[model samples]
Target chain A: MAITGVLRPGHAQIRVLDLEEGVKFYRDVLGLVDMGRDSQGRHYFKAWDERDHHSVLIRQADKTGIDLFGFKVDSEATLEKFEKDLQAYGVTTKRIPAGEMMNTGERVQFTLNNGHAIELYADKKDVGNGLGYHNPKPWGPDAERGIAPTRLDHALLAGGDLDQALDIFVNVLGFYLVEEVVAPDGMKIAVWLSCSNKTHDIAFLRHAEDGKLHHVSFWLETWEKVLRAADIMSMNDVPVDIGPTRHGITRGATIYAWDRSGNRFETFSGGYPAYPDHAVITWPVEHLPEGLDYAQRKLHETFLTVFS
Target chain B: METQKGNTTSVMTEEAYEYVKITIAETGESFDCSTNESVLEGMRRLGKRGIPVGCRSGGCSVCKCQVVKGEYHQHRPMSTEYISKQELEENCVLTCCIKPKDNLEVKVIGKMHKNVCEK
Candidate 1:
């Protein structure tokens, strides 16, 4: 297989103001399958197509933001190798024991220069999508649920020190640069990196704040699913930041909205498949307005300033 | 008889609603805020565009502001991470979680303050 390490985004633990409200919004509106709550009063969920035990977790907290983002490594050996590679790269790593999170193996966690926590782990219980592996059905009941997305796609994190952060993902983690937006002075305003065939597995923005989350996006099957998400958000009164439009950067159809607790989430589809040998695409800062919203061609004011 | 009944219904509706005017300290923009809804909700409902609308709950701390004049009731807690207890005592509040008890003059203090005040 071409992809051998850092398989995909495994899970992200987000903090919400109210537990039940967060649960309803995620379960009903966002349409992730509920995997039930843990002993710590934290609830877990997985997208309809994910075979893992969970991909999203929520806990009640006074503040709101992502707690940690995790990537599933191909094997325990790859996890160990990355831990050593990160440490050798002058980045300190911490090993969180297995069972700390339900059905999760030991995790090698480290803090990025931007004050965000990133974790890598190799083991998690595989709970198959309702359709069995042999002679599987095309879809199931969960597919018909509210705005159900096939998978958790990518996240754009905002903070300073992106150059240093890029080193960790590119050099140590085996991710390749897919696209970037550059300032006139040649400073990179934003960068999208990928670890697999997806255009971007994660992206970063240059901002004054540390550990800021722009949005965690989910992948839909088509452009129609993205439009359906807009309808669902309107019906529920979810505050939409932008979209139901296309992004010139990845050419992905998108809609950015906030959860009940103000954390931004995206439902999107369509982006060209990326390969390691592909050339990196760059957009100048002046063209960012068109890059962000290709259809509207307006760089949303809130897109730059507001963040949880 | 129908005219009297309609007049009584209108009076009851007004009595049931309690609205307090809120003035933005920077722009002098004003809006009527109902006692039942947060200031951010009133601003959004009236399309005031005074403050950056955030989670209409206490969580994001995006709609943070300080009441420079008059009084209000905080419907929930503002995490000390954004506003300390001392700041809360000084009338600093998250507009999404506070309702004006009387006419108030508030200054936007959150990250998007420039969008509201400068504009």
Candidate 2:
């Protein structure tokens, strides 16, 4: 039986606010290039690597959550087979026609068993002309040449039922468990799952409220990039959520910042790989008791006054 | 079929006599659990602890697992309202309501990695 693709070899894709604004932030601020867009007006950007059409796709969305996550499968046939399999399971699957999006590759998409949307496609975009790195062009005092992001690292989402979502991703969708977090109140809060050796391609967060997309992360070429991104955010007066800290699981150094539209983004360096036989690890929520405390310090610093 | 003295249904099937071996990841040992018993009950009977079971009903997926190698059917229809059917096809079965018709190998799916101290 042909299994659905897991971590197909490629870069990450994202949906952004304004195409021009996103381009300015990624290209002018972060120093990336406009790889191009598809018929749907989705913008594609590339890093220093000149191997493909565009590693990142930023589409304009009216909303502020993650629109979808794309993973490359081994072959186009695998994509087709997954489409059939998903149909058999009564999942509503859609095939994006070539040229409809920035990447001309065919893609099959469906909402995950957990409500998060996912796309599996064949990426055939051109590895553009190799543009090497540029110098430390300072956009501000904090602006340093941001480290080039290698690929889409992972997306973090907050949902209500983590176990149900995890089962869908791990069992039905072919993703593997990296680790899980359970709070003291008997609530299973977050889960780290992946398709490849990298610790996790997607991390699910279960908060007290309704489920929503938390953030999307990209892998930086070096630790310097993470610092530089932090500096850029600080310089631009963007709200910094947390970070330049190391996660206990991925152990990667990360910097978290909000975009112009309040979407959270992270630039990180280094993470573990994912493997089939690797034992799934679990961490008690008590270890990090702040409760999804991305910015624990900030929460304690102030309280809301109704009129103010 | 008659009612048992304790108001329990006495309609037992030959399938109840069939032995189903369950391999719990925590214990790394396989135990002989009857087909009529839920996976959670089997674990409890064997004195296996730390499985993080809550809300014995399927409403809570704390007892979820990836059925690696067996054909255990759920006592009630599996609901995709909470988890998608695709996930169920991928071998995710809630142990609280599943009845094994054959030997099964299941890996715990949620929060199985929690530190023993937290449990």
Worst 10 residues of 2 chain A by lDDT: A299-308
Each prediction's whole-model lDDT (CA): 0.84, 0.59
Q: Candidate 2, which segments miss by more than 4 Å at Cα?
A: A1-4, A8-17, A128-145, A184-187, A207-211, A289-308, B1-119
How do the candidates score on chain B by TM-score?
A: 0.77, 0.70
Shift in Å, residue A229, candidate 1: 1.2
Give the number of the best model, judged by DockQ: 1
Would you estimate the TM-scores of all the predictions? 0.91, 0.60
In model 2, how large is the Cα lDDT of residue A193?
84
lDDT of 2 by residue, A20-115 (tens): 656666655555556766767777776654356665667665433456667777678877877887777777888888756655588788875455
Which candidate should be chosen as best, given lDDT against the real structure? 1
Considering the true interface contacts (CA pairs under 8 Å between chains A and B), give the fraction that model 2 also has: 0.00
Worst 10 residues of 1 chain B by lDDT: B1-10
Model 1, A1-308: lDDT tens per residue? 88999999999898887788788888888899999999999999999999989999999888787888899999999999999999999999999999899999999999999878999999999999989899999899898788899999988888898998899999999999999999989999899999999999999999998998788899999999999889877666666778899999999999988877778899989999999899999999999999999999998877887676
